[model samples]
Target: MRRWFMHLGALVLAGGAAAQSPLAEFDPADFGKVVIQPRQSTSGAGGIAFEQAFGNYQNEPVIAYGEGSQAVRLGRPVGRLDMLFEDGSTGFCTAFIVDDTHLLTNYHCIPGLPRDGVQPQVKAAQFVAGYIRPGHGEGVDRYTVAPNAVEADRALDYAVLEVFGDPSQTYGRLELAGVDPEDGEFLWIIGHPQGQSQHISREGCAASSPAVSGEGKLMHTCDTLGGNSGSPVLRLSDKRVVALHHAGDSRTGYNMAIPMARILAVSKFLKGAEGLPAAAPAPLPEVPAGACDALWAEAKGQGCAGYGAYLASCGTHAFAGLARNLQASDCGTAAPAVIHGALTVKPSGGDFPTLAEAVQRAPYGARVSVWPGVYSGPVYVTKDIEITGAGPRDQIVIDGVMHWSRGRGAVRGLTLRQGVAVDGGSLTLEDNVITSPATGIALRGGDAVVRANLVQQTGEAGVSISSNGAVRVEANRITRSAHAGIEIRDGAAPEVFDNEISDGAQSGVYLHSGGGGVLRGNEIHHNAFHAISAKGAVKPVVRGNRLHSNGYDAVRLREGAGGTWEDNDLSGNRAGGFRVEPDAGNVLLRGNRE
Candidate 1:
């Protein structure tokens, strides 16, 4: 006999300080209307009589399923989520499966969402498998849920669980909708409403709206009660889950659900999920262009302050992406972005009238959105701020250095004509293209991470580091440099990995002045000098590199430099493989393939 399985998570009213209270409000009446219900039940009897109170009415049909019923196939995925908390109070909600082993429910049904996607609450709870009617003539088949299989997001009021076995192979799994159901589409909600056995609200349930006050949410007329908190809102046309019912308004009989689109965006547990439906059309919000020229120099900042308001004005639709990212970081409460967290800047006309003003006016750690156009001035980054291009990386060009100071921040998707120079502080640069006549990145500072970038035609080195902080240079391509592709000195420890260095006028990399770190997974070729040159007290750990067709020696460890080189492809060099000077001490070079 096939059994419909459900692996549920835990739920509780979490404390406020650690997890920010959700700005989005949900009426608790919709979560579970029945109170103090038993954790276990076998008979399909109503836990208690539906009381006649407070002028309540029901236009929806609570249809019970039997053999040859219309809802038998549709109700298979809908199973009971029996949760027993540490306080010894047992609560049961509804959950459904999206895959062979994964189930979706409400975050309030499982309070503590693991940042690491491991569900520890599953072990502390039980699941009443196949608890619905038509299949419940025998006895309740209880399944013990394993630990670390639940993932929850309290803000969205949703939780996903991984079952121990392949249940999708038996009862089958429901699909998730990327778009909402068209108007008048029939909807079905199956759950143990009012703590009763699972029943289907086959009629008087459909998607309606004036969103229950947030982005990517649907207002549905699903007759739900307490235990229905995690029930799936299914679109009858295709039978895909459109949303997860969370709360309802008792005064209006309107219920709200978290849209599946938002769930697909925010849930880390669904990363790289295949066999899912296609994504619906999601357009980026439009941003206006600007001039950061003489007209705005007099004003400290013009129109720039209004950009934040404009971005915020796009409503919940523009905020879905931000909400997804925040939920992944376990911060669902901070949804519906506050403009106070970000700032807007323009090139020469729109906001601030210049890139310089955006830098000067933006608060520390604030995200600055710079519109497209050639901003012909150096941006002095004095504070820890993140500056992003409103358009493509090539569309937003800064003809001067994005000079860094004692600030720590990130710079992404910007084209720096003169390149970047960070003198101090912790800085991370990613996906940036630097076309400089001098140096692409002159990092005299500490704690820098330069990754997935392109550096071209440097008058000096492609990258220069002279600090003591832990720096990481990963997945970067340095080409056509007038000097070395990379230089590290002054006792700096920089880990350079998975970089492509070629066509440089000098060595591919240089380490001097006691500098030391790791250089691995790099493609070093066609340089004018040695592929790598280490001197002084520098002793780096080098491994897993391809050094080929260099104009000079593959590696030169001279003047007291010692190195551990292993697992490298050393071939096609014009000169010798490596040179270890008499005073450079014995270097370890092993596992190299000629």
Candidate 2:
């Protein structure tokens, strides 16, 4: 996600210089990678276990219908990543050649951003191509990663790194598809799962429908594990790279990948195939009131006498009716009175009977206000609009899922039952009460402002930010979560501050799996676990927070996790204050007392 902690001025840590030193000798057994457990799914539609399909490569079982000859050669460019962190730890991921010099992988695979005075955790890394089987390293081409030659976007969860040598000349790089994969289209993944030999997951793997896929991400039923983080998802029909496989969720019974198109749109080091569709033009900036007269004169010069004529001539213009609306108005006191489209949803005698109907019928930039009543949902928002509950939050409730994908909007003053899921775009979730069997507010691949809300008793986290979600959680009270009060993982780095979080079954604030962010000025206590817990390459900035009376240590850092912890009050914790595991990396502790 977005880098929230910028100036980490003069970090002070114990054994910091030693942790930053290069390893004198490399030992495979000493450094270890995080092993992500495979989430089990009872649904037959879920991914087939890796053991069942490609476990015995000698006699690969036919896992899907219409068994045919497989294109095993497509795995040529795929490779396993071996990384050595500065902390003397190691990890492995998957990567593939995208061009002659550059390779594509997950940002989390090399989750290091050397900024200001901080250094990247990865001291050195290499890519091993053509490692087809365990103990079969002969003939495999190894290339070192070019120093500081990495371009990554945490929000997109993709990285492009230059290799020291042109290994693609031998293996050949893969071309990215210009478009997203069609729903239900079969896809293939070639990678090193669990750091094993190169294996292709093709049988029964297909893209999920758009309704289920969300935005900016392609959900698929592909068998993958921790080491498969950066695998390229290839379209079975054209054999073109369509997405970059990233994380898997057992709760959803699908694995998630970053769409190649989304990555190409913002990438500076990579380009899409020829004939890639052009992006939509950005909306024009708002016109100033002082320019109204000049604009009106220009319109009149074009043979447009009135506002109606000007609108007819330039209906697509951003200021189509601005001049006419402000002709006789003072710029300061009598500004243009602009009217926006508005719709109402009520139990009866309103523009629409259901919130879903109003949202579907409302045009972009419209307002949909809900009256006092419980509304049944599964409301899918796909346009830019504001949805506000006109009555009290509890009086106007949404009793099911509210899914917002590829839309920018605000949802305010409502009591939500099954919770809200934001997949992409920017959304403001404010002044609402949310309760759910799962996460009260789940964000993936989007920017959201979650402020001044009450989220309680979620079966999962009260607020779960994952898969590169950029969120600002402020002034919220979260309690009684079955999991963490706020769970951040899979490269999400949210800015969380000024919140009251308590009574979580897990940590009040839990971060792991390349997650980092700034947690400041929060009141966190009475959790079953630590008040704040971080692990697995995370580096959150925890400062100015009152943390007390937790079941375990107030703060715990393990598994190469390190960050700046400053001026936090750590008192009355059952297991003492700060506990850093032996394998923990460089943690900066300044002005903190137990």
Candidate 3:
């Protein structure tokens, strides 16, 4: 049954009371922001553009299943799923149980999420049978996506995955149609829209265009939103799936879906060749010094492709001595640790009200504990001290720029806004949510530990450290950054691991111009370009990351960059798996799990 929690204007819990609520139950009429990667308008001239609303675009949103009591009447084929990934990243989308364990969703929804370098990274799939306001408390049932059970087509945009157990026993399965829906047929689109409850859109929505998208896709007028990516657009008469909802026009007139026939065909083909391995990792070949010298000289002129035949010529461990010879500067000098156990500047007892004020008042050897509230920043701390929050990270928010000027400072349990710049300090940032301006954590000339932080939507990088990249970025969830997730550039070399970085406009982790580092066990996927982009005379040890579902190469090297690349899961990328520009120096590649 659909559980109605409370109204938006007057939300009253059993004991607690909130004047306003964020739940969709109170305001279900408006859908949230569409989360798909925005595409260029097909609405312009000579584009596959669509414009003008096809039907009444301004209708009151109808609550699906009427608060869950009508679940018996509505078909049980469609439902909502919340995908949980390693590194504590989460996403929601729509899906339908197709077989005992098999399920259908858009490829974008589950792209490269199943594996973390041959290991299962997607931890669970929480299914909300009657996905209403989760705050009302009960209706979520979670199932794990089975390891190596993902099959997808990036171009066509459809995926078939197997759940850990049989969802068919509870939700039942949706039947597939081999036939196409006729244009103007009544299209009943049912799925969770905007991460709200399950919704059904039928007001003036119909199958309008046939094959308007890549082969056999149907364009319709079904109202959908971000979380509705994998919605099943069913024909009203029988409730069988006609198309799988994928993309929508931002102009509010049209949405696109892959036909059910195409999805079924792809599923059949994938059933046989699932978990296909990547090609054998090619190592640097054995060559005479003169030959290697000649190739390098030619590559400097023509490019790396000039010696393409010698994949990694110059012999294994060719650059090992060179990599070891480089020294970390005096910037690696040790700093004093922050003194703990002193309480100062809190909401109640301390002299100051804000975090910045507290840090300023506190001596070099004291600790500051802030209360649960939005603390304004430039919370610049120059003293070697510890700054903590009252409770969980979500409750204590620092709403401005945070900077650590002095070395050996610790910050915990705070959601920082704007961004943070730490230089000449050994700072530790943990359990904080940080959005960005330019870079989320700009660690210039600092040795820091950034652990378990949620960094998102940054301009330059999620974590951008300078020449002295003496930092450890681990277990952090970074997404939708304009540049690299962890940009170790200009001679910085940091240890980056266990981070889930996705949808980055540039490489997941970029190593540029004398930067050298180790990238291991990081789930780097769905980025616009390479998972790891190495440039200049840098040699990074890139290993054991799930580098897939990317637009370009899994790893890209240019100019004089080379590295040890091995044991990564590379598949389903738009371009070839890995590449090295002809001018790139010798790259030692071997034993990668493709």
Clashes of each: 24, 0, 12
- Leading candidate by lDDT: 2
> Model 3: runs farther than 4 Å from truth?
1-350, 467-469
lDDT by residue (tens digit), candidate 2, 458-524: 9999998884756899999999999999988898889999999999998998898888889999999
lDDT of 3 by residue, 1-594 (tens): 221122111111222322222322211111122222212211221112112223454212335334432232233556666655554444556777777777788765665323213322555554555344423335545566653336888666677877766766555566666667776877777776545555667787788755345545688876655566677777754445777877654343567788776666656633211111112123323577777666556644553233332224432224321211221122232222224354534443344668888777664446676655566657777656777764335555788888786646688867787888887657889877888778998888757898998999898799887737468889999999999988887788888889999999988888876888888999888999888888898998888888888888888899999988888888777786788899998898887755
lDDT against the true structure, per candidate, is: 0.65, 0.71, 0.63
Given candidate 2, what's the lDDT at residue 348? 61
Predicted structure 2: lDDT: 0.71
List the lowest-lDDT window of 10 residues for candidate 3: 3-12
lDDT of 3 at 585: 84
RMSD of 2: 26.7
How well does candidate 3 match the true structure in TM-score terms?
0.45
